[model samples]
Target chain A: MSRVHDMGGRYGDGAVNPADNATFAQDWHARALALTLAAGALGQWNIDVSRHARETLSPKDYSRFSYYEKWLAGLADMLVNLGVLTREELKAGHATGVSELASRILKADAVAGVLAKGSPYTRDGAPNAEFKPGDRVKTRRPAHNIQVAGGHTRLPGYASGLIGEVVLLHGAHVLPDSNAHGLGEAAEPLYAVAFAARDVWGDEAGAWDEVVLDLWQSYLEPTA
Target chain B: MHFRAGQTRATSANLAAMPHDHDHDHPHTLLPPEPALRVRALETILTEKGLIDPAALDEIIETYQHKIGPQNGAKVVARIWSDPTFRKGMLDEPMPLLEELEFYGRQGEHMVIVENTPEVHNVVVCTLCSCYPWPLLGIPPGWYKSDAYRSRVVREPRKVLAEFGVDVPDDKKVRVWDSTAEVRYLVVPERPEGTEGMDEDALAALVTRDSMIGTGLALRPEA
Candidate 1:
């Protein structure tokens, strides 16, 4: 088994410089445009009405709004601005019956143009070079540059290079490295795996001490 | 912008000593108090521009901040502590079990309750964003929102807990729940000792907001 080591460095140290960070932010802003288009094209508001109640108006109404909402909201705002639908139409459709209105909007060429551009969602992270569940694997301790309050650096104070097994695939999420820089960057495939106590801390661990973590696919390497 | 190697070393030492505190007076700086503020500002603009009725904005702000989140959490906690079958139901299939409670928060239709025991510890974070089990634990804490906690907690559970003054023994395995999507997590912390005979209300009282969020354990009567 290869020993995973965390060569200490700053968060966002390897992937992004200050310049790349700016670019990432700009990319996120641009992506917001596409997200709005997709939402409009899909008649997301109507979908919300059917799923939630009439009282639930904006998708933002959903509690626990996060970074994703910004993109969706920007998308909706653009749709209204593009003359795809009058704000009144969107609002009225939200109240009662809007299937016909939604159908018309969904068919609009302008709306189609925006949707055709497709999603600005990007995949930006290390590629996973490991196998699926039941495969024995170990976590690699790559030196990560993390930004702290007053400054930024990398340290291995945490459980770095701990061994575990892949349990579930968590699709793609915004890479932590991209997020630290406020770049509004893309997501990567992540996994949820359970690590046995003995593997992580040897005999010191309790019999039931099993650690579960969501690791980026890139952070893993297959064990022989 | 010069990265002095020695300065970096000193900073790490300082962080180790101080262990970043979340009790900053400026709470809003940690999480966006902006959503509410922005809603208000939008309402004001709309009102001035005659875009919306005055009452509409007020309702929006009220529903989101006060009515939506904490109420959901309280209901879920109450339901689990009171009903045994429901407790088992929750442990078995958390998502459907949560719906039976009939108190759903935004993004909380899907839920998971991770059990925390004497031997094992659990904590939740939304590394990419602040995804929390709002239906079961209420709005997340400021520390949960801080980039330091989000990035470090999943990777370094013990160190992160230590910063929060929660020193789990090295023998105890820490499970960090990384919430994404609509799925959220609530920590079913071990029901503290001394409260074995306490009523549901008393037990609920002992279940501090932090315990629900998985930071600290539920309170027990002093020995």
Candidate 2:
């Protein structure tokens, strides 16, 4: 189902705010960012799982809360679901005396190094790529009945079900849709698929413009 | 932005549960008044549970805040401007060329640096999500994540560029790169004219975060 987070090609009420960027506006924003990285370093849940937590939030909460606030909410929910913490503890905003499971902990000293050596999504010994540059392919659309309730998917909502030309085959890599759900590292070929603006958004788009998107093998098929 | 019946109920229940004000009319103006207090609570709870280390949190923040940012990208762009071979190498094998500058990891894992020439202008947006090159650009700006930017940029690149004060001529073609996967993009902005004698450091100073994102152009040096 389409969520507020999937607002691609969706019109908004006002003009796009072109204000300058700020790293963090509020102190809590920094805390939200830090806690996310620290918890992510524990090696329990993958980044996709974290994303799913946020995606499943009540659409109301999803749009109302700011970006980092969403991060906090997702982190809290995952902690409970993973048995790291309980719902009671989260509501109370403090740890209960009862002990919880602890498999691994990211130490303070290792934080910098851990983050510095970021987790690469690429996997080893993957199969050869199916499509190459200059190949014409069509984007695969998810079946209407298909539901992605609690998992992750790299397939963007807007780019789906369209025709495009393969621009570059980025050597086989881990499929994020599978990796995000703890479904093991299912490696596959990724490609940069370039679609003519008219093909994606109709004739309203500029004739000279093209939108290039990086897509996984599963999302494409040879265009007849 | 339509919601299901279940979602509607969930929202109502959530709103009722929280002892907070709701400004449904204007969500943009909504800011949690007591964010610091809530952050402290969450941090305290996690620390006590041994799920996270406070020191580690500090280090992570410090690194993103001070160490990594657009300055690092400016260095790469500067090298490209100064060394023709390096620029060619970037267009051919981006990962290896960028790694030479130690600018590879995180969102910067697989990059394709698009050069802006006299006839074409390039811009980037992750219509799906905020898939920016963090190692090179640092954290993305809030507008980059807004629905307006994500939706309109691909549809009307020329108009969006104008809003950023970047006006491409009618003859110039606009290319929008939508980052949909691990591969990221960094726009190699056109080198400003009248800066023919600037050193590498001086050239690096002209590259801003927005320039690399293709929303703005490189700054012209003082005459």
The model with the greatest DockQ is 2
lDDT of 2 by residue, A52-137 (tens): 66765677877777777777766766565565666667667778863443334577787655654555666668877888899999
Question: Which residue pairs overlap in candidate 2's backbone?
Answer: none
Give the interface RMSD of each candidate. 19.4, 8.5
Off by over 4 Å in 1: A1-163, A167-191, A195-224, B1-57, B70-83
Per-residue accuracy of model 2 over B62-169 as CA lDDT, tens digit each = 877888889988998988899899889988887776666777666677788898999888999987567788889887888887767887888788888888989998
Task: Give lDDT tens digits, candidate 1, residues B120-214.
Answer: 78887665445565445444544555445665555455666666567898667677665533345677767766665666666666666666666
Ten-residue region with minimum lDDT total, candidate 2 chain B: B1-10
- lDDT for B148 in candidate 2 is 76
Task: Return the top candidate by TM-score.
Answer: 2
True contacts kept of each: 0.05, 0.45
